[model samples]
Target: MRTQVAIIGGGPSGLLLSQLLYTKGIDSVVLERRSRDYVLSRIRAGVLETGFVDLMKQAGVADRMEREGFVHDGTQIAFDGEMFRIDFKKLIGKTVMVYGQTEVTRDLYDARDAAGGTVLHECSAVNPRDLDTDAPYVTFLKDGQVHRLDCDFVAGCDGFHGPSRQAIPTDIRREYERTYPFGWLGILSETPPVDDELIYANSERGFALCSMRNDNLSRYYIQCDLSDTPDDWTDDAFWDELKRRIPDEAADKLVTGPSIEKSIAPLRSFVCEPMRWGRLFLAGDAAHIVPPTGAKGLNTAASDIHYLFEGFDRHYNDGDSDALDRYSEKALARIWKTQRFSWWMTTQLHRFPDQTEFDLKVQQAELAFLRDNEAAQKALAESYTGMPY
Candidate 1:
């Protein structure tokens, strides 16, 4: 089989790129290693950045999101028992939508199916070949047979553990990574959220987050040792820890219930430089990763797709190659900025294992400044809402 672009991932980033390309009459095929149901089963972040929302609109897939997603004008932050709000709308005229990543993926899949886009699921041993040459293709196993897909270019949106990143030769690839000393123990419950907006709390006990999928579903998290697992905590214990971290008032009103989903995710900040390797381009987790503290994971991936989509659109529609040539330089610029923000958020909210009294004091002062100073709040709002495209 032959296509203009052979995309090696059917995740949201790759699907979004394919859908966006389709808007301009570009042709592509998405290859996914897992079944559709498996992809949908993976729970992820629920916040959407303004830039990501714009891309969904451009792809003509924002109907359900607009109808069901809640618009959050700001988020609340807490330290000890005290809490303050940073108004993204009031400070910067911007707002975020509370929409789950799973929902976004589902919407994209529906749009792709309606458009008759090719998305091959359960594709095993998928590999991008001849990446350094102008003619690139992907090979994979299906139905006990080997298949090859020829294409003008390949998109490696297969994620961190996927073969796409390893395909980039070691000599040409450079990676930066920092694994946190702790992880986030999270639970999803069928209950009303503690507040209308999300709350990020830094307590003497640990770091915690209060978020929601809708009025009836609440998601909460608390910092835990890296070695801990979901089986280690019971439903009631998780609720108690979460309540201890947030403000007393909010916790008083917090509704508890049986956890439908529970998991522990270790925090990490990672980036692979030069997101491009000849005819093969990387996007999403294949190129970068950030701590979940600031909820930048999926949004950063969307930004990569934005740049990749623009490059493809220009190459196919406008006879322009400038954007394609500068894809890496441009994407990394924004990626690093996001990395810094996520790092800042993680450091300010979590207790480090080796942190001294001075470090704890500094963290407290940082939160205090963010709460008391409008300038600091404005800066937080700007980064939180997202910088420019």
Candidate 2:
């Protein structure tokens, strides 16, 4: 089959791009490696940057999100036995939406279904070929048969482990990565959050975060050794560790419950240079990854899609090739800034195994400066809320 654009992944990034292009009357096809049920079952970051929220609305998929999502004007930061609030609204006159990534994907899927967009699931061996040429295509296996999709352009939205990134010839591709020595052990429970807004804590024990999905679905995380797994800690042990890492005020009010879900995620930052390789363009996890500290995982993906969609919209609708040509330059500019913020947040909040007495003191002093200085607080708020797209 032939299409204007062939998207390699049906996740939020690819679906959002397809939906946006559809609004412009452009035709595209999305191929997902897993079933829709499997995709929606995965849990991911919930914090939504302002730019991401706007993109959802532009795609006409924000009806459910805006109705069900919570607007967080600020977040709480705790250090040295105390917690303080960083008023994003007060500092930058902006706010972030607290809507789960799973919900966002669901909304996008529903929109795709309603629009009768082509989204093939459980397809294997999805490979984009002739990416450097004017005409590129993807080949995959499904139902014990091979199929080819020809397109004017291909979108490599298939994530880090997917085949999309490797399709770029090694001679032209550049990669940078950093894997943390620790991981985050998180649990989801049907209990009220310790506070109304999310709380980020840095204690002598480790870093912990208090977040919520809704009024009753609370999410909490604690820094752990990379070797540790979910089986190493019981629900009660997880709660106790979390309480110790946060402030006494939040810990005292924290409600304990049986964990509905549990998992451990290793922290890592990855980036691939030049998101665009000729007729093939990369978006979301295919192009970059940020540690969840700054909550930029999905938000960064949204920014990439924003840039990619702009390129597609301008080229297909306005007959402008300049925007499409500058896709990588434009996307990476914002991506690096996001990576720096995530790295900084991770360094500031988490305890490193190699941290010396001096290193601990430096972290404390940095947090103290952020708390005392209005200008520093403004910088954090601006970054945490998100930079302009």
lDDT of 1 by residue, 119-206 (tens): 9999999988888887888999988899999999999999999999999999999999999999999999999999999999999998
Q: Residue 61: error of model 1 in Å?
A: 0.4
Distance from true position, residue 260, model 2, in Å?
A: 1.0
For 1-389, candidate 2 gives per-residue lDDT tens digits of 99999999989999999999999999999999999999999998999999999999999999998899999999999999998889999999999999999999999999999999999999999989998888888999999999999999999999998898899989999999999999999999999989999999999999999999999999999999999989999998999899899988999999999999999999999999978888988899998988899899899999989988998899989999898899899999999999999999999999999999999999999999999999999999999999998
Tell me the lDDT of candidate 2. Answer: 0.94
Q: Which residue segments of model 1 deviate by more than 4 Å? A: none
The per-candidate count of clashes, in order, stands at: 0, 0
Off by over 4 Å in 2: none
lDDT of 1: 0.94
